[model samples]
Target: MRTIESYLRMLLIMTLCYLIAEWVIDEPKGTVLFNPYVLGFLFFIFLLVISFEVIIGVLERIADQLTTPEQRVALEEAKKQKALENKWKKRFAEWLIGKQTTPEAQLILEDHNYDGIRELDNPLPPWWLYLFYLTLIFGVVYLGYYHLFGGSDQKQNFEQEMAMAKEQIETYKKTAASFVDETNVTVLTDASSLESGKSLFEIHCAICHQNDGGGAIGPNLTDNYWILGGDIKSIFLTIAKGGRPGKGMIAWNNSLKPQEIQQLSSFILSLNGTTPQNPKAPEGTLINQ
Candidate 1:
């Protein structure tokens, strides 16, 4: 039994429930109204709704007490309107479920019988049937487009994205800071880059190589002896990819950009034959040869 009055009350109840939930999650324990403005706004709304309901109740009570003959007739009309609304609600519910039969329609009863029971001749709802047909059509289109017609699938899209990303990276390398491996590296002779490389080395690499690339826990970088290779490309590869495990050198490629690594290689190479305080004894094949 629903009336416009009942619907408005339901909305009021729902608003109160939402406000209660808001008050709970908003503030943590021991923190007073974490956001005073928002909580205060909610409180104001609550008071407004309560005051509105009180005013409505008082007006309704006054109208009941002051009812005249015309007002009584209007009240009866309102009751008829409520009954009409209920009748429509019932009809709509039956239509939506697609399972209602009028008493006069005896022709729809089926011949199939079990004991004293008989089934009704009923078809599925038209809306449900149309929705099913739409889904089937969509399925066929999807299958043909993605598979038979060679449209891009998830794997193809992923691979295409990866290829595009790789191409963009290569283009950027050509225009900006280019990548350097052992095959393409050469000693950078400029003083500014060398100074930058020196600074980068001291900050990120000085722990094991010492403050001056003199080498303490790692090989002596100043001497002619080379643990890995001593050429520019060799030094670049060694520094970028690191030496073998237990050699105390980790890859700097992840931390430093390719151009910066190139500068680092040149700086280390420039330090060759330079004297260091108590330099570690040279350990590999002589590279100054």
Candidate 2:
């Protein structure tokens, strides 16, 4: 019995340590025995348990060798005394189970006999009765908290969470306009987009290209001639990445949102064929006259 108890205690300690390790390590893929850290922890636990058992076995052997016959008799007497001291614990266990009637004392019901087999009146177990009572109390509490009171139901909670999630998605959409790059960019010709683009151009690009995009320090945007290319994509890239290396126009990618850039690009394209106050001499290859 002692050996079995020792083994059970060691197993319990190992199980508790394993649970602690699992709680500490929050692995998204889920922890497994094969995981290096988990495997190492288990190995260490195994070694510790084995060492403990080995030490206990050696101590027991040493005690046996050192003990005299008279001491052995005294140890047996002490064990009996210890058992006597714990007699109440055994009685308490029996009390919880309730007293069972012996075969001789059992009352047989002759009226309930079926096929020559008589029925004995057996009471329900005390532990099971206690558990049933607890369940009844729990059910009452549950009903009072959720049904009687104004506690939100599962459906209401779900709807509220979904509403919050929907709001978050909407917010992300508004902010994610800046996530646009050269590949997915398209020309926006709406009045509002053009106005916004014009505003941005006046603030930033107007310094080099002049207010009318007729060219000052930069090449003329009103003309069809483009130093790079005349296409919308080419213009967008030029605006985002800048005119050329060591040249006048600096990259506006850091300063402007992609949506804003798209707007500016659209407004710049709208200037094609339109007259400027003082057009600079065409400096690049003309794609369209």
lDDT of candidate 2 over 1-289, digit per residue (tens): 3564577678898888777777777764345555887888888988998899889989988998899999999998998898689888546544556555678648544467688888766665677788889999999998998989968989999999999999997777668865666766787888999999999999998888888989888999999899988788888899899988888788889988888889999999988898888888887898874
| lDDT by residue (tens digit), candidate 1, 85-193 | 8887656544545554567465788888899799867777655777889999999999999879999989989999999999997787677645666667778999999
Question: Against the hidden true structure, what lDDT does model 1 obtain?
Answer: 0.78
The lDDT values for all models are: 0.78, 0.82
Best by lDDT: 2
Model 2, poorest ten-residue lDDT window? 89-98
Q: Provide the global lDDT of candidate 2 against the true structure.
A: 0.82
